[model samples]
Target: MKLTTKELMEIIPHRQPFLLVDTIEELEPGVRAVGHKCVTYNEPFFAGHFPGEPVMPGVLQIEALAQTGAAAILSLPENKGKTAYFGGIRQAKFRQKVVPGDVLTLEVELIKVKGPVGIGRAVAKNQKQQVTAAAELTFMIG
Candidate 1:
């Protein structure tokens, strides 16, 4: 199922300047999800990330993907009303620079969920499907 930013706001606690996801295109409990983050030159971070050349930070890409995964898990009845906080990251790698006008596609797949903890693999790509970053993220639900 797909969710707009408003619906996503209800599922994830992140707010403006931090809520990287613009919309969720696909979602499947304990499985996978696809979300979007549209990069614009007007973004606050762009002003300082670099004076003339603004590149979306790699960590933000990972966070964007992780947020998508959190949304998927949070959508479940068992996780509703709870928060998913980042526990750790593994094998994170940045492959390219993400700049203004780029639509970041975040794809995540749940690897395991036990108790209040979950692990997942996530990747961020551009409109052309070129991977910009990827990582294994651990989340602690509360």
Candidate 2:
């Protein structure tokens, strides 16, 4: 199923300038999710990320992927109302720069979930479908 920003908010607690994922294009509860973010020059981070040339931080890209993963896990009937935290990150790679006007596509698939801890494989692509970032993320539900 697909989820709008509003509906996504009901599952994950991120908001405002921190809510990186704009929409969930696809979701398979506890399995996988695909989210999108429309990058714009007006993003608060652009103001200080750089002076004349702004680049979306690599860390934020990872967070966006985590958020997509979080939405998938949190949307599950058993995980509703819980919060997901970053437990660890591995094999993270930033392959390209992400700038304004780029629509970031984040895809995450849960590889393992046991009790309150989980791991997901995540990848992010730019509007051109070029991989911008990728990583294996660990999450802790609370």
Candidate 3:
């Protein structure tokens, strides 16, 4: 299923300027999700991240992955109204720079889950399908 930004807000707790994912192109409730983020020079971070050369921060890429994972999990009926807090990040790698005009494809699949905690395998790719960032994310539902 696809989820618009408005419908996504109902499942995930995030707002603009912080909310990274612009759209969820694919979803399987609690299993996985594929999201998109259109990187633009207008992003607040670009103003200070670099004066002349603006690149999307690696941390924000991971956050986008986490948000995608959160949306996947929180969309479940049992997880409605719940919040997913980052428990940890492991083996994160940045392969390329994401710049203005790039469309980031964020993908996350739940690898494990028990009670209120879970782990997800995530990756972010650029328009050319080149890996831009990747990580294993752990989360706790609250």
Candidate 4:
């Protein structure tokens, strides 16, 4: 299923400026999700990340993937209204720079889910399919 930003707000708590995902292209409950975020020069972080050569931070990329994972769980009726928090991250890798004008494609797959805690593997890639970052993330839903 696909979800718009407005419907996404009903699940995830992030708001403008902090909400990185603009839309969900696909979602499979208890499995995986694909989301998109358009990075523009007008972003607030562009000013400080660097003036001439602005690059989206690797940490933020991972966070965006995690946020998508959270949305995946929250979109499910069984997990609605739950707050997902970062639990852990492993095997994180940053392969390329993500800059303004890049359209980020976030992919997150659930690894495990036990009660309110879950583990997922996520990756962020640019439009060219160059991976910007990836990690194994654990989240607690409460």
Give a tens-digit lDDT track for model 3, residues 10-96. Answer: 999999889999999999998999999999889999999888999889999999999999999999999999999999999999999
Where is model 2 poorest over a 10-residue stretch in terms of lDDT? 42-51
**After aligning candidate 2 to the native by TM-score, how far in Å is the CA of 108 from where it should be?**
0.1
The parts of candidate 1 lying over 4 Å away from their true place are none
lDDT (CA) for every model shown?
0.92, 0.97, 0.96, 0.91
Ranked by TM-score, the better of candidates 2 and 4 is 2
After superposition, the stretches of candidate 4 with alpha carbons farther than 4 Å from their true spots are none
- Give the per-residue lDDT of model 1 (tens digit) for 1-115: 9999999999999999899999999999768889999999988888989988999988889889989999989999878888999999999999989999999999999998988
RMSD of each: 0.7, 0.5, 0.5, 0.8
For candidate 2, the per-residue lDDT at 32 reads 98
User: What TM-score does candidate 3 get on C-alpha atoms?
Assistant: 0.99
Using lDDT as the measure, what is the rank order of every candidate, best first? 2, 3, 1, 4
> Please, what is the TM-score per model?
0.98, 0.99, 0.99, 0.97
**Model 2 RMSD in angstroms:** 0.5
Candidate scoring better on TM-score of 1 and 3: 3
**Which stretches in model 2 have alpha-carbon errors above 4 Å?**
none
Model 2 clash tally, residue pairs: 0
What ranges in model 3 sit over 4 Å off?
Answer: none
How many backbone clashes does every candidate have?
0, 0, 0, 0
